[model samples]
Target: MTRTLEWNVHLDLSEENGTTKAEAVLDTGSEKLMGHGVARCNPQDVDIPTIGDELAASRAMKDVAGQLMRAADREMEAVGAGPTKGPLGKPYAWTDVAG
Candidate 1:
C-alpha cells in the first residue's frame, strides 16, 4: 500500500531590531519538501540594518530543511520502523564516501 502525507509550516524570525518570515510545504509525491524564506529591513531602525532579500530567503529555506528532517525522524519512530542507527558495523576504508 502507498500513503501520502502533507505538511505546512510558517516561521517568523525576529532579530534585535527587525523581523523576517518564511513558509515551507512538504509533499510526499516528490520525496522532498519545498521551502521559501523571506526577510525585510526596517528603514527607520538603523540597528537592525538590512539584509538583502536573497540572504533572508536562503536562511529560511535552510531552516525549513532542518524542520523537515526532524519531522521525518519522528514519523519513522512513531511507525515503529526501529531506531535509526549507524551502519551495522565498524567502518572500513572502503566505506568512505570517496571510496
Candidate 2:
C-alpha cells in the first residue's frame, strides 16, 4: 500500500533579536503530531544568521523524521515485517544549483 505523509513547519522570526522559533507538524493521513525547535543569534540584537536558521530548521526536521520512522517501524513490526537494515537510505536529487 502507498501512503502519503504531509509535513508542515511554521517559523517565527525576530530579525531584531536574531531569533527564530519553529513549530512542526507531521500528518500520516490517519494521525498527526507536533514538534518544535529554536534558533538564536550568538550575539544578541544582531541580524539573524543564516547558519542559525539552517541549524534550527534541520534540528526540527530531524526530530519529525525520527518520530515518523518510529511510527512506521512499529506498524511494520505488528504486521510481522522483517527489520531491514538501511531501509531509509536514499540519495538527494537537487533541482537547483548556484554556479
Candidate 3:
C-alpha cells in the first residue's frame, strides 16, 4: 500500500567567538528527534559567518541522518528483522561524524 506522509524539520543556528553551532529538529506526528553540531573557525583563518553556518548545518543534518538510521534499526529489530546492518553493519549503529 502507498501512503502519503509529511514530516517537518526546523534548524536553529548561532555563532559566537568564531564558533558556530546548529540544532536540527525533526518533528513527526508521533515523535520528535533532535540533533546538534558545531564548527570552530581557526584563529588565523578568515571569520566567514556563512561558511561556518554551512559547515555547522551540514553536520547537524548528518546527526539527524544517524538518528533516523538508529530509529529504523530499532523498528526492524522489533519486527524480528534483526540489526539494520545497512551501512553501519550493527544494531543501532551510528555513522561517523566529520572532524
What tens digits encode model 2's per-residue C-alpha lDDT throughout 1-99?
997766555544333366666656766556766666677877645554776667667767777878887787898888989366656555334643432
Best by lDDT: 3
If both were scored by lDDT, which would come out higher, candidate 1 or candidate 3?
Answer: 3
Candidate 2 ranges beyond 4 A from true positions: 1-18, 44-47, 82-99
List the candidate 3 regions with Cα displacement exceeding 4 Å.
Answer: 84-99
C-alpha positional error of residue 9 in candidate 2 after TM-score superposition, expressed in Å: 5.4
lDDT of 3 by residue, 1-99 (tens): 999999999999999999999999999879988999899999999999999999999999899989998798688899999554446543332455432
TM-score of each: 0.37, 0.57, 0.80
Query: Candidate 3, after superposition: displacement of residue 37 in Å?
Result: 0.5
lDDT of each: 0.59, 0.65, 0.89
Worst 10 residues of 1 by lDDT: 8-17
